[model samples]
Target: MNHNQQSTDGIHEDDAALSEFLASLMDYTPTIPDELVEHYLAKSGFQCPDVRLIRLVAVATQKFVAEVATDALQQCKARQTTVVKDKRDKQQKYGVNVKHQEYFADSPSTGMDPASRDE
Candidate 1:
């Protein structure tokens, strides 16, 4: 599943996390050198070295994204076992709400009853 060039399983949800991913790209994978990458950028009239780093980083990033995505998929599938569910049955799962939910008791049966809604 380590198809780095593929689109579906290729990328990670967080693109920013890729640069810090394990293993260097140029060292492990086929890619341009950092110096050459900068050369191309400079030849193209780009001034910032950081911008060049961005390009090299993309390749460096692929390895981690692949590793993470595969691990995540495996973990999720592993959680699907009946044994896991049996254990979870005794555990109460809590749902978090980021937004307030409106509540009312015996509030109304319709948008408005003219008599009841009138101030």
Candidate 2:
């Protein structure tokens, strides 16, 4: 679908594109044009331009934080699924963790008993 198309949820594809663009802007200088800034300032009904800009930045920051939090939760869910009975299965499915092999051990009891080992 094109950017102008409206989805079942009533949000236009352009809205999503705009949101993505704005999120990317947060990563750089966020050099919004003065005319666009003035437009938003006027639409916001705020008398002071400084306060309007502050509120706009605050909203953008909040949106970015929420998106990051949601992504983290999704990653946690995917990681949780890697929990299986066999170590080889987990390794085969999720690959080995060379940095921390113990984290993906097939069995927690697989660790050697230091007490039983004769020094």
Candidate 3:
């Protein structure tokens, strides 16, 4: 493989694409029961634990970590988009003024303005 070559044997066009595909492959969660387990074991060459408890724990750990990583990526992307939009608005000098906030709620106002609220 030449250094100047655009294409490689294993690598695709962009690294991000390959990484995302690998991430998705690792993120698969299946409800494999005892019957399914026996079937898979007979088909595959690798050795798996006979203990049902350990298999369940492995499945749960894989699922939890994948979900957490995917969620973190999504949150980061959303925040990045918001920051980009804010930066664009600032550049434009729009008449509407809004401040960035992390209310942990859908709406910062939450249907009740502090100035107008009785409580």
7-116: candidate 3 lDDT, tens digit per residue: 66336657777566546544444455445555565576545554443345446655787999999999999999999999998889966658776557666566787786
Residue 102, candidate 2: how far off, in angstroms? 32
Candidate 3 accuracy as lDDT? 0.64
Instruction: List, residue by residue over 1-119, the lDDT tens digit for candidate 2.
Output: 65445453356566887677666654544334445655666688855545345445656766787899999999988777665446668667897557854466666555669675443
Residue pairs whose backbone atoms clash in candidate 2: 87-106
Q: Which candidate leads in lDDT?
A: 3
RMSD of each: 20.3, 18.7, 20.3
Q: What local lDDT score does residue 97 receive in model 3, on the 0 to 100 scale? A: 54
In candidate 1, which residue pairs clash? Answer: none
Local distance difference test, per candidate?
Answer: 0.60, 0.62, 0.64
Candidate 2 at residue 14, lDDT? Answer: 69
TM-score of 3: 0.37
Sorted on TM-score, best first, the list reads 3, 2, 1
